[model samples]
Target: MKLKRCFDLVAGLIGLCLLAPLMLLIACWVKFDSPGPALFVQQRVGRHGVPFAIFKFRTMAHDGTAGNVPRMWPAPCITRAGHWLRRTKLDELPQLANVVLGQMSLVGPRPELARYVACYPPAVREKVLSVAPGITDWGSIKYRDEGSLLAAAADPERTYIEDILPVKLAFYQRYVDQRSFWMDLRIIASTVSTLWR
Candidate 1:
């Protein structure tokens, strides 16, 4: 775990440094493309049941519900820039800051909103939250097109809660039980390849 933390810190710092220019360009584009701030922060359940602010590049239009529970895909609130950002997964770039702050990991179970975390069985919750949340994970890689999946659902949130969440929980448990430096590297590589494709 110590080594993992060290890797996260170093990788996070390096990522932020290397991507700073691109991130700044994206931020500016987001700002000019919409009426809202470039960055969005929302509360998320972290390791040990703690709550932390998760950061992202704002993809939705400015609205009172922006920080509320994530809405289903193909909703009207998304801005023009949002479509491209979400499609390219650039919306998640800001989470590198979360990684640098020790609020997240480079590879682990992705964090969830409090409401979703509350739905987890006690034992499952305990196991999943044992490690810090991450920007990328096996669950994330598998569901890279999650928005499209939700778009096809009759009740997106329900499908998420009843179906997707369970599968993600299982993946999370698997990650928790088998996590190591090499595993993290593989997950990261998988994520990058998934994105590249």
Candidate 2:
């Protein structure tokens, strides 16, 4: 909607301005913490199933690979500072830029990696990809400690595909079906409160 778009633009701009110093500090910390670029760009499935690069402050070591890899949560690939960034969700700050660029929305379904997107059935993909991908969503708030959850699994990827992803997809489809400006605001407020708590 027009109001939602305006809200995204205004809030995103304000967030960027207010978080500028923090973002800079994070960039410097990431650089010193690891021998790789401060920012990480990964291809994600966005609106209409389009592929776009999602940006975040690098929260893993340079050699890290996407998705579940064997038994570990790939924890070893995360640098010390990266752990803090990921834990505090500061790594997601860069996505405000993505929202500003119209590559994403303030709230909707979280973007999926191309590999995961490939597993989405055609009908489900059509429903989920109907709107712009978001930085946070119901699934995100509910599964805030997803890394730990995955770590507990005997086969993380299989558990994700069979269980976690289906639940997330249900929430995603619900959001798509009933999304409104006020709903977005509520989601944002809920996210902030959840994070604070």
Candidate 3:
């Protein structure tokens, strides 16, 4: 895990350097395209269940609900710029800083909203939160089109809590139990491939 953290720190710095120009452009576009700041900061449950602010490029309209609402796939207020950013996953670029800062990992369970963390079944939550939350994981790969999947549901939030959340927890626990450098490499490769698809 020491090596994993070292890789995360190094890769995060490199990623930020390489993607800085793109992030800047997106930030500028978001500001002009929406009525809110370019960055969206939210409190998320981190390693050991500590709260930390995770940063992403603001991809929803200013008027959208600030709460950690479950159906985040599509909101009426999403600007045109935000839509493309989300589609390409460019919105997640800012989180590289979180990686550099040691608040996250490149390949671990995705961080959940604090409220969602609170709702986690006790044993599952404790096991899942044993490690740092990550930018991507097994569950994320499986649910790559999560927004569209939720949009197809009759009750998106209910579907998420009942089905999606549990599956994610299982995957998270799997990662927690089986995590290693090679596994992280595979997950990174998978994520890159998914982004290209």
Candidate 4:
């Protein structure tokens, strides 16, 4: 997947350059609208069960998430600006750094919190973690409304583990089985379309 890495490096660098201004604006909005750093740093499981600190815009209030849970979490802790950032997916822009650093791919299984990854069955986990995790993937587009769906559940954590996660895992398996440059391109295109809608 050296070619994929090359694409990720170039695209990530270019993306950061192009989105710098908008990222700056969002950073300001987060600062003014809340009392924390604009960047949210969290440990997620990368390829082969390795942990890495991935970055996203702060879409929750300071001290909102003392711990990560494996569930949809558009909680009351979301600030006004944070809500918008999450809605528009602008919060994920900083992940270009992760892409450039080779911690992630542009199109592959979305990285999961270690807490969530811990829940994966042994064989399933091995297979899923065999490749680099991604910022967007087939599972991501299908589960684009995950936060909202989780918000509506009677038990968000339970629902995610029992329902949402399995579905996402199935898609992950398909993506792994069928992956290629063209498939990656399609996944990226689908991701953009999902965001636009």
The runs of at least 3 residues in candidate 3 whose Cα sits more than 4 Å from the true structure, single-residue gaps closed, are: 64-74
Best by TM-score: 1
Model with the higher TM-score, candidate 1 or 2? 1
Give lDDT tens digits, candidate 4, residues 4-38.
Answer: 99999999999999999999999999999989888
**Consecutive 10-residue window with the lowest summed lDDT within model 4:** 65-74
Error of 2 at 73 (Å): 3.6
Instruction: Name every residue pair that clashes in candidate 3.
Output: none
Candidate 3 lDDT, tens digit per residue, 1-197?
79999999999999999988988999999999979889888888899999999999887777546545432755675678877887788888899999999999999999998777887989989999999999999898899888778878898877888989989998999999999999999999999999999
Return whichever of 1 and 4 wins on lDDT. 1
Misplaced by over 4 Å in model 2 are 64-72
Q: Candidate 2, overall lDDT?
A: 0.86
Per-residue lDDT over 1-197 for candidate 1, one digit per residue giving the tens place of the 0 to 100 score: 89999999999999999999999999999999989899988999999999999999998888766787484554677889888888889999999999999999999999999999999999999999999999999999988888889988899999999999999999999999999999999999999998998
Residue 39 lDDT in model 4? Answer: 86
Alpha-carbon RMSD, each predicted model? 1.0, 2.2, 1.5, 1.4
TM-score, every prediction: 0.98, 0.94, 0.95, 0.95
* Maximum-lDDT candidate: 1
